[model samples]
Target: MSFEVGQKVAGKVTGITHFGAFVSLPDNKTGLIHISEISDSYIKDINTVLTVGQEVEVKVLTIAADGKISLSLRQANEQAKPETTGRPKPAFNKENDRNYNKQPQSDQAPRFNKSSAAPSRSSYTPNQNNSPKKEGDFDSLMSGFLKDSEDRLSSLRRNTEGKRGGRGGRRS
Candidate 1:
């Protein structure tokens, strides 16, 4: 039988890998059951849940242009559960909505107040002890650096001049 999207069908688990499981559908076609679709919780090992030749009900999700099929077991279960009931009730439960809207705030640990958080190292804080050097200290540092730079330039100029004189001012 041909498989359609949102249709629950049975397939045999042909192979299981770390990434996902390959299943052979009734129509002799193959589809993949991704590791994430295997269960609702974290799945560290795919082998524990599925094995070769195991029969599984899967819902076809999509068929790619390359002929690859995507299937989901959880969606099949969810869809099947609702169809069993005669009258379709609202999917949403009022109790869940009431709890969601009127839930009391627990006295848990206070959350980090990012709006009133302390300034990071990259941000400027005028009163911070580790702030930039004072104006006088900055001026003194710049003066020392300028003197050292001037000395280096003077030594470089003297060396070039001495070389020029020793070589008769300019090369022939």
Candidate 2:
């Protein structure tokens, strides 16, 4: 029987390699399941995940012109399981959005109360003697970032210029 892409087929693991596993499909066809496709998580050893003569349900991923079939063990397993999200999402509509944020709603999480969190403005004022604040100026922020990067590069060079000894070093 011929297999098409995305077709779930039952097969027996015929061989295992460091990179993947060879599975014998019907009609004497064989497919390779790459190590990455073996599991949802990392599999340190292919043997640990599969063995010769083990039955598995694999989804056909690709059928190359050269008669090579790429299969996925994980994809087939995912198909067998149903997804579960705790709460059903509300359908988006203009009416629901218009009422949002006007008042507190039980369904929504509590919003951060800015007024309650901060001290009264009359109680806290900046001292006139302090340096000018750099908040909200794009030019000042960009220049500060560039200056810090330049200083870091200069210090890194100072620390590594001698330790990076290699054939590229200039002849004295």
Candidate 3:
């Protein structure tokens, strides 16, 4: 069978080295499952999960242009499980899996009174009684912001007005 990236296939562990394990793929092709790809968790010893001549299912993660193959055991197991079909039925643990695909709707009832949790339309109407307040509306916001900016600039200027201003007070 032809192997494609992301396709899971059975392979035989032909040899094991300290670095990784060599697997003979289904079509007489060989691939390496790196020590890091041997499992989902940290692997202190590759022998714990793999043995010479052991048959295992693995996913093809990459096939280099020069024909080098990279496989992953974690991906194969994840793909082996069955997925759900779209049809409402009794509650099942599988429902949890669906959560990964979509976010749940809000559980709280919608507020209709327009007093609590509802945006006050009057606050953003621009020209009507509920228009938003711009800085010029109060004539103070712009002044405050400008004053703060001026104060910071003045402080910075005063700090740099000394002989220790450039290059951290260096003579150069």
Q: How do all models score by TM-score?
A: 0.48, 0.52, 0.47
lDDT of 2: 0.88
Better of 1 and 3 by TM-score: 1
Q: Per the 3 Å backbone cut-off, how many clashing residue pairs does candidate 2 have?
A: 0
Superposition TM-score, candidate 2 onto the true structure? 0.52
Cα error of candidate 1 at position 156, Å:
32
**After superposing candidate 3, which stretches have Cα over 4 Å from the reference?**
81-172
Q: By descending lDDT, how would the candidates be arranged?
A: 2, 1, 3
Output the better candidate (1/3) by lDDT. Answer: 1
lDDT of 1: 0.82
Estimate, for each residue in 30-108, the C-alpha lDDT of model 3 and write its tens digit: 9999998887799888888899999999989999988889998877886777886778786667657767667546895
Model 1 stretches astray by more than 4 angstroms: 82-172
lDDT of 2 by residue, 1-172 (tens): 8899999999999999999999999999999999999999999999988999999999999999999999999999999989976799889886669776677768987778776787878764243334455586898778866876787788888777766754354446
Per-candidate local distance difference test: 0.82, 0.88, 0.79
- Residue 157 lDDT (model 3): 75
- Cα lDDT for residue 138, model 3? 50
| Best TM-score among the predictions, by candidate number | 2
Model 3: which ten-residue window has the lowest total lDDT? 122-131
